[model samples]
Target chain A: MTLLHSRRQKEIRKRLEGMRPRLYRVAFAWTHNRSLAEDLTQDTLVKALQAARQLRELESLDAWLFRIMSNCRRDHFRNQVSTENVDNYDLVDERTPETRSSEQQLIQKVRDSVEALPETHRQTLTLVDIEGFSYMETASILEIPVGTVMSRLSRARARLRKLLATQHVDVRGNDSNARLRRIK
Target chain B: MTEMEHITEEMLNAFIDQELADNDMMHVYLAMSKDPDLRDRVCELRANKELLRAAYRQVPAPRKYQRPPGLLPRTAMAAGIMSLGVGALLGWYAHSFSQSDNPPRTVARAYQTFDSKVKVVFHVSRNDAAAFAQILDEAEALVAAEDDKRSNNSVRIVANGDGLFLLSAKASPFKDRIRILSEKYNNLVFAGCSQTQKRLQRERGLSVDLLPQVSTVNSGVFEVLRLQEAGWKYIPI
Candidate 1:
C-alpha cells in the first residue's frame, strides 16, 4: 500500500478510537451492564477497523460506526439468554458520588424509566434522543421503515413521560427488576 | 377548538421532535398557544428528550481496552479471495471444448418430469424471508396448477435451524401473508421444528412464539425425510 493510503487508514483509526465513549454510552444504556457494554464497544471498533478500507464516504462515518455497534449489540442479545433476565441486574455503583444532588437522582430515575422500555423502542429512543441521529438515519440503522422509527420513538417518549410524571403509574422497576448504575 | 381536537399525539410528537415542515410547525405553534393541555403535553415530551440526552451525556469510562497491535482479519477480504478460487474451480469442473451429450428439445416436445407427484415438502434451515416468500409462491403455483383436475396436491414448508425465523411472530415480516395463505389453502402446512424450538428456548432462553397458523413437527429434517419417503418431492430453500 502507498504511504498516503497508510496515513488515511491511520487517521480513520484515530476517529474510530474517538467514537469509543459514545459507543460505550449507548451500549451501556441498552445492556445496562458495564463489562458487556465495554466488550461490545471493543467488538464494534475491531470490526470497523478490520474493514476500514470499505468506508467510502467520510461524512457517513458516524452512522456507519453506529450501525456496526447496533449489530454488535443485536448479536450479543441473540447469543445471550431471553429478554426475561434483562433488567434483573445488580446495581453495582463503580463511581463514588460527589453529591446526592436532585439532578443526579432525576437522571437516575430517567435511566430507570428508559430501561423499562421494549428493546426496539429503547434502541430507537437512544439513537434519536440520546445520540441525536436523524429519523431517517435511525430508520436505516434499525433496518425498519421511517414510520416505524417515528412510532417507536413516540412510544418510548410516551412511556418516559408517564414514568417521570410519578402520577399515573407506579411502574418504576422494583428492587428485583433493578439496574446497574455505571460500568467502569 | 376543532383544530386542537384534530391534532393527534403523533403530530404533537413530530412538532416537538422538529420533524414537521414549516406549515405544520406553524399549525402546532398556534394550537399550543390556544390549548393549555396541548402546551403541557409538548413541554413534557420536550422534557423527556432533554432528560434522556442529559442522562447519557456522561457515561462510565470504558475499562483499559487494547488489542494486540496489528491489522485484523477481514471477512470480506477472505470472502473475495475465496470467491475467485471457487470461480476457477467451477470453470474447470464445467469446462468442455466439444458439446454433444444430450439432444436439444423444443418446449413443445418437453415432457413432464414428476408425473402424479403433486406433493412437495420445502425444506428450509436458514433465516431468509425472500426464500420463504419464493417457496410460498412456488407452492401456490403448484397447488393452483391442478385445481381444475382436482388432484390431491399438497405443500408442506418445514422450517428448522435459523429458518424458524420465517414463522416467528416477533421477527417475521410476513405474519399477515402467512396467516392469509394458511387460511386460503387447505392442503398447505407451515411446520416448525420442535427440536429447534426447544434448543432455542434452552440455549438462548427465548420463549419462541410462533404464529397461530403454524404447527410443530418433531424435527424439520426428519419431517422432510418422511414426506420424501412417502413420495413427496423434496425441495430445499
Candidate 2:
C-alpha cells in the first residue's frame, strides 16, 4: 500500500510538471506580462501541490489547476493599478513604417485588439478559442455556468471582429481621428 | 440579414465552433443551405476564430520563470539537492547507472577533479523548438567560455515532458546536432527520463527511441536532484 501510494504521488508530480508549460502559456496570455504570468504559474503549482490531498479525481486536475490560476490572476489584479498612463497618448511605435512588415503590423493589431478586451471576455475567448477548451471545461476553470461561458465567448468573438475591422480601416492611412474612432 | 433572424449570432457562433447539439447543427446546416447570408455569417465566424488563433499563436510564453520550490518532501529533494558528500555521489551514480532497460553508456564526468569545475543542468520541459535551439546555443557558449578559462566543466541536459524531443529517435530534428555536440564535448551529457518514456508509451502509445549519444535516467527530476546535490548548478530551459 505504501509503495502504491508513493507511485501515485510520483504520477501526480510528473503530471503537474508536464502541465507547467500549458499553465504558463495560459497565465501569460491572460496577464500579457511575463513576470506576473510566472508568479501566477508558480502560485498555482505550489497551491495545487499543497492541496493535493483534496484532489478527489485525478481527471479534474486540469480544471483544478486552472481554477487556482484564475483566482491568482484575480487576486493579483485586485491589488495592482493599470500601468498605462491614459493621458499620455503620444507613445511612438519604435519600428519605423519602412521597417514594419504588413503581416507583422496586422498580427500586432490583432494582439492589441484581443488585449483590449474586457477581462472576463478575454479569458473566455482565450480558453474557448485559443486554448480550444470546451464550453463546459472553460466554465469549470472560470467557475461560471456554461451559459455564461457561451455568452462571453460570443461577445468576445463579435467584439474581436469589430475591433479588427476598425483597425483595418485605421491601418489604411487613416488619420488620428479615424484611429480614435476605431478605439472608441 | 432577414434570413439570419432565425439563427441568432450566438447560435451561429456555436454552430461554427461545433458546440451545437446534433439536432441544432442539422438545423443550422439546413438553414445555411437555403440562406447564403447565414452561410456567409458562419464563414465569417470561422475566419474570426482562425485569425484569433493565428494571432495568439505568435504569443510565445516567456523563456524563463522562477519555478517555485516544490512542497512535497520528495519534490523538495528533487528540486533542491544540496551539500551531498562523496558517499551520496557514488550511491546516486551506481543507482542511476544500474537501472535496467536502457543504461547510460558512460558515467557522467560529474565527479572529475579539475582546477575550476562548473556544472550546469538544463531542464527541458517545453516543445519550443526555438527555445531548445537557444538552450543549445547557450550550452555551446558556456563550453566555449569554460574552455577559454581552462576549466573542466560538465553540462547535462535533461529532457522530460514535451522536451523529450531532444532525445526522440523518430521525430526529433535536433538528433544530429545533439550527436555533433556529444562528439565535440566529452563533458556534456544528454539524459532522457525513463519515467516519461514509459508514461508516453503507456498513455500515448509512443515507443520513443533515444539517440545513440543520449543516456537514460531513472527519473529526470531525480537525476537533476542528484546533480544539484553534488554542487551542480540547475537551470530550466
Candidate 3:
C-alpha cells in the first residue's frame, strides 16, 4: 500500500474501534444473531471505508454508522433468509440461572414474541425501543412519515403486550379455555 | 376520553425521547390522566425501550477508509503522459481514479434503506427449561393476538435445543395452549433444530418429537438467517 493509503487506513481503523460496540449493538438489534451482527458490522466498516468521502460535514458519526448498519441489515433481510437460529454471538453472557428464572423467562418470552412481528413493526420497535431514536429520526431512517412511525410503534407495543399476556397464561398452568373462563 | 384512549406507545416514546411538541405533550398528559391502560402500556413500552438500549449500549462503528485491490502504476503513466504533454491528462486520470477507487456514492446508496425492519432470534439452551416453556407460551399468545388483529398475519417460531421441549407433547408445559394457538393462527410455525435433537437422542438418550408443526432445520443460526431473509423481524429471547 502507498504511504498515503496506509495512513488513511490507520485513521479508518481508529474511527471504527471507537464505534465498535455501538455498531455491533445496532447490527445485533437488526439481525438478532451474534455472528450475523458481527459480519454485518464488518461489512458496514468496509463499505464505510470505501465511502468515507461522502460523509463530509455530518453532525453525528454515531448516527451515520447506525445508518450504515441499518442498511446492511435491510440488505440481509431482502435476500430472503430465515432468522430462527440460536444467537451464539459470544458477546453477551446467558442469563444466570440463580436470578429470577421466571422473570427472565418472561423477558425472553417477550423478546421471542417480538421476534415474530412483521418487518415494519419490528424496525419501528428497534428504533424506538432499542436504539431510543426519536420519532422523526426513526422516520428519516425508515424513510417513512413521522405519523407512520408513531402508529406502527403503538401497534407493535400493543401487540407485544397481548403476546406477553397470552404467554403468561400458558406458563401459569391454565389452558386457553381455563384462562378465558377466568378472565370472563 | 376513555382511560384506554390516552398516551400511546408512540406518544410516550416521543415524550421520553423529547420528540413530542408542546401541543402533543398536552394531549398525552390529558389522555394519561383518563386512560389507565394506555398509561400502563406506555410504561411497559418505555421499560422495554430502556432495556433494549441498555442491551445494545456498546454497538461498534464502521471503518473510515479502505484501499482498493489494485491500481495502475503511477510512474509509468506519468512518464508516458509527460512526453505527450499530457500533465493535465495524467492529473485528471489520477484524480478520477482516486474518486472511483472508493465510490462513496455507491456506499451511501447501499445504505439508503438502513433500518427497514426488525430482526430477532430466540436462544434456548438445553439447561434453561423453564425459560423455554415461557417463551413458547409467549409465542402462542403473540400468535393468538395477531390472529385477532390481522387477516393475513405471518409469525414463525423456531425452536432449537431445549426450545424443542415446548413443541413435544410429553414434556410441553403448555401443550394444549400451543395447540389452540396453532389452530387459530395458521401463520404460527414451530421449528425444531435437527442437530440439537440428534445430539439429544444420541448423546443423552432423550427422545425428540419432530411434530408436524415443528419442522426441523439445518441449524439455529441458519434458521435465524432464513427468517431475516423472509423479512421477519427478530428479537432474541
In order, how many clashes per candidate? 0, 0, 42
Residues B99-134 of candidate 3: C-alpha lDDT, one tens digit per residue:
354532221122224333222234343434544554
Among incorrect, acceptable, medium and high, the docking class of model 2 is: incorrect
- Stretches of model 2 off by over 4 angstroms after superposition: A1-5, A81-99, A169-184, B61-237
DockQ of each: 0.20, 0.17, 0.13
Residue B204's lDDT in candidate 3? 96
| lDDT for B227 (candidate 2) | 69
> Weakest 10 consecutive residues, lDDT, candidate 2 chain B?
B80-89
- lDDT string for model 1 (B60-110, tens) is 554433223473535533442343233222222221101224432311111
The candidate scoring highest on DockQ is 1
| Candidate 3 error regions (>4 Å) | A1-13, A80-106, A169-184, B1-13, B34-38, B54-237
TM-score of each: 0.53, 0.53, 0.47
The alpha-carbon deviation from the true structure for residue B92 of candidate 2, after best TM-score superposition, in angstroms, is 21
